[model samples]
Target chain A: MTRNTRLLMSMIFWAFIIYLFLPLIMMVMMGFKDSEFIGFPIRSWTFKWYQVAINDMEVLGIFAYSMTIAISTTILSLIIGTWAAMALGPTKFRGKFILFALACLPAVIPGIISAISLRIYAQSLDITPGMWAIILGHTVHNVPFVTLVGIARLNSQPESHIDAALDLGADNVIAFMRITLPFLVPSLIGAGIFCMLTSFDDFVRSFFLGGYEPTLPVYIFSQLRTGMSPEINAISAIILLITAALGLSAERLMRRNKKKV
Target chain B: MQTNDSTVRLQNISKKFGSVVAVEDFDIFIEPGQFVTLLGPSGCGKSTTLRILGGFIEPTEGEVFLGDDKVTKIPPNRRNVNMVFQDYALFPHMTVSENIAFGLEMKGQNKAQIKKRIDELLEFMQLDGFGDRKPDELSGGQRQRVALARALAPDPKVLLLDEPLGALDAKLRKQVQIELKTIQQQTGKTFVFVTHDQEEALTMSDRILVMNEGRLEQDGSPKDLYYHPETTFVAGFIGETNMLSCSVKKIDDDYVVLDWQGNELRGVCRSGTAKEGQDVSAAIRPESISCSAKKPGNKGVMKAKIIHRVFKGSFTSLSLEVDGVKDCILNATLAGALAEQLGDEEVWISLDPDYLSVLLR
Candidate 1:
């Protein structure tokens, strides 16, 4: 309300912003430091760590492995979560709230708890700690975000569009495919990227159910156990760049979709 | 037996949501090329009945017939009916041309046929050169016409419109109502329109079915419903009314004498149950009440004080208080300028006996 309070608020907000970005800035700066150890007085700067991160075959393989798992998790979660969302969207059934709660319960539980339960469940089903197991765990965690975003988008859709499609002689499947799915594409893409990015960087579940070959996050954790190096910082900075790009595109698309709708 | 020449037949339709009845025992047979309106207030089962006809809603108990075939169990896609939703319901993803082509494509029409029909409809709805535009690109009225074009593209047996003009401004709504009626007649398609607006129903529909509380109150022509409503709900819901609660003093062959606040007023016996000493309401329209400064010589006349005068452009509505009655306010709508004529505080009121129909419950 007053000038002093406004000044204080501005000071606090800038401090919080700096507090959040300072570590990331430091980590990215440390990647360019020309020392074996990552104390960041960069007496010399070189692109050699970035070159190593790009050229190392093992790191390349793990990055690709993480990408493949994220893609699979995104696909599976989109299908299952969109189904859950549609189920929760238009129906007036008695158990609809219960169904929605169950669909979103995984997102509320601790990631460690979800990982341990998934590991135990996989073991009970005679499944091995492999890529399939890791993908399954990631999908379970990612689906709730898809479902939440999908339901919200679906709610914004007019119920009459589907009805008009039906009145125009489209069957249920055709109506959904033509009218509802196209309407949901923006949210689906946004939610899909969200799912993929979360799955890619996830460590707890991947650590529990990962195969002999490590995903990038699991491999990074392994590298941390061995030692701290600028190589790891370079890999993380690259991953951050990719995530930023994807997140920005997703946000832009959702904003554009909002304007269109 | 299925009736001949009837385009739609809703047989003993009843819909219940859990324990609440939405439409009860509603039966109507619509002839071909007729513009019928299910007219009522909101939540009064008009939309529910229309949805039943379009097969969007399944009545808990009913059999629907389109022409000679029964379509009660059929879905909306299989039924030979199309609906223009209240919100226009145009697909936001599709262009106008694509939206119009959707129904035709579903009918398995060839590409050429679909294109030809789309052009024809765009022209018919006066939306030429606007086919490629998306719904958001168009104005409210243009979007409504586009919705009409899309619904008409399929050439269904019956076209259902659920308050499609409700979203437009008042002037646009009147323009669209006339355009829609003209389009229906030109195409000779059966139109089952639904609206809570009585004026719209009167202006467009050949037949209006007035519903109240899940029951059909009255079904007749616009003039018939306006002049000769069978129930009080129809009278009050259709237009402004001066419901003079009176008792039947005497009933003759052609006229019934109702004693209204100690005044004997003659009115047409609408429902034929005007017995002696029975309570009834004289449903009098304000336009039917003639007002003059000089006392009228009519037998059932009222000398009233002018309470309030609201001057409309075409006519003036004056609220009058009857002498010797504490709260008996009678409204009179007189044509032309009456400000110069009625300079006195006291006014004479005379009811047109023909328009003053006695409604008996």
Candidate 2:
């Protein structure tokens, strides 16, 4: 290709990226306005909205609840996913295809269907639809995604590693903990962050299963029903900032680990 | 009780992955302090047999006895065997000292003892100052030494090595092979190695088990396997040999007359199993055939023309095709002086029947 074609392609790529971020830019601009309602133009800039969201006890409680659900979902999914992947990835057995299909069921199924099924099951078990329900539903949707990342990481690992460890007198558990686990650390972190973000931004499951409790996404949706307020914009801005920081940190950590290895 | 020459024995061992037989009814006896190599081409059950001996896989059929103890069902963690994998398999996360000390730590050795053993092994492997370096930080040869130290730290009954130096460059591999042999001699541990390289097997092994298609073709000392291969497969696998089809003309008690390409060649039958009017293939090493520009009044000289010449340092290989005989390649080491005038010239080649191996057709 000519230089002009390359330059035009790069410009188009940047344009696509900017288009993706246009809504977030608008949200942040709307967040800083001192007006009672969010609009296109920011007439004034103030810290009052930030203070409002930071000081609201009810909103703080919801944030705490959402954080608890997100963190628990991430940890539980990582454990289940890593274990399931390790058990099924390297070993050969009968019905391996069936096991793989079952493991992928969660990722292929629609999230809302899983949410409805979870709500039905939880109701039958006399477990009320609340924070716990959201945790269970998010786990159902995120575990398979985490398992896929774990499987890819495990499959790329050399089989000689486990054999070497065993030859060095390490049992199965010791080999997994010492050799396999450390090698999977970067992918583990990557998968955990992905699960956490998936749970954090999920709305349909939280909307269907949550009862008398609001996750962050549900809370944002409820705020949209009422007129858009600067306090809500401020919360959105804080969430956006947190996600960007987390993404940058994850990338930086992966790079550092790669270099260290 | 033979205390010094105790052997590691495998009895009717068989392993199958589903229906594919990786190792089938294999048996081997490795004497103590002997360097025995399981030499075969890839997928010929050499590494699989090594892994089975190392206790990484339970045999599907029979038992393993190490100095009278049955160990077929023993796990790799409990077996007194350590393996150096093809890629070295050094722990990328651990320092050289930590990697070497791992086996000792697993055996519940005290930290002080572990440190001392690690230090001694480091010194022995000439990696004394590289204790703190990770496997990736060190060079390929250094990582291999660390792997050796780790496997040797526990002083296991058998040290299993799976093509350990296969990943190195040719020059480095030769140097490390010498160092490994020295280490094996100093330690006097039973070394069970696996490789497909013919030269490596010839140089390193006290005894070599030649395998093919999951079956043991032949097993003997290096000289035994090299000088007298049991079958055509063993003959071709062990070294470079020209296997020529011949019909036995007359077989006396100690002598056999062979008709090859309408030429009657009188040669001694070492094992003397040839019957009269039987077909057999004779394995003749290239170096066994001595070539000269003029007939030297030798017993079995054949008139042949040189087709091609390959100049190897310190030696030369001449490809010869006779008038009524098939092409025969001859290798001679005394090159610049003896065979210089015979290049591209009609030559008479002499063969010693003592170096000939006859196998059934």
> What's the residue-level lDDT of B134 in candidate 1?
92
Task: For each candidate in the order shown, give its overall lDDT on alpha carbons.
Answer: 0.90, 0.84
Q: List the residue pairs that clash in candidate 1.
A: none
lDDT of 1 by residue, A1-261 (tens): 999999999999999999999999999999998989989468999889999889999899888899899999999999999998988996689988888899889999999999999999999998999899999999999999999988888888988998999999999999999999999999999999998999998999999998799988888888889997899999999989989999999989888887777
Task: Evaluate candidate 2 and give its CAPRI docking class based on DockQ.
Answer: medium
How high a TM-score does candidate 2 get? 0.92
lDDT of 1 by residue, B1-361 (tens): 4455448999999999999999999998888899999999999999999999888889999899998899998999998788999999999989999999999999999999999999998888889999899999999999999998889888888899999999999999888889989998899989999999999999999999999999999989999899877789998998888888899999877798888888878989756678899999889889888888887676778888888988888988888898776666888888867655996588888888898889997
Chain A TM-score for candidate 2 is 0.91
Weakest 10 consecutive residues, lDDT, candidate 2 chain A?
A: A252-261
Residue A2 of model 1 has an lDDT of: 100
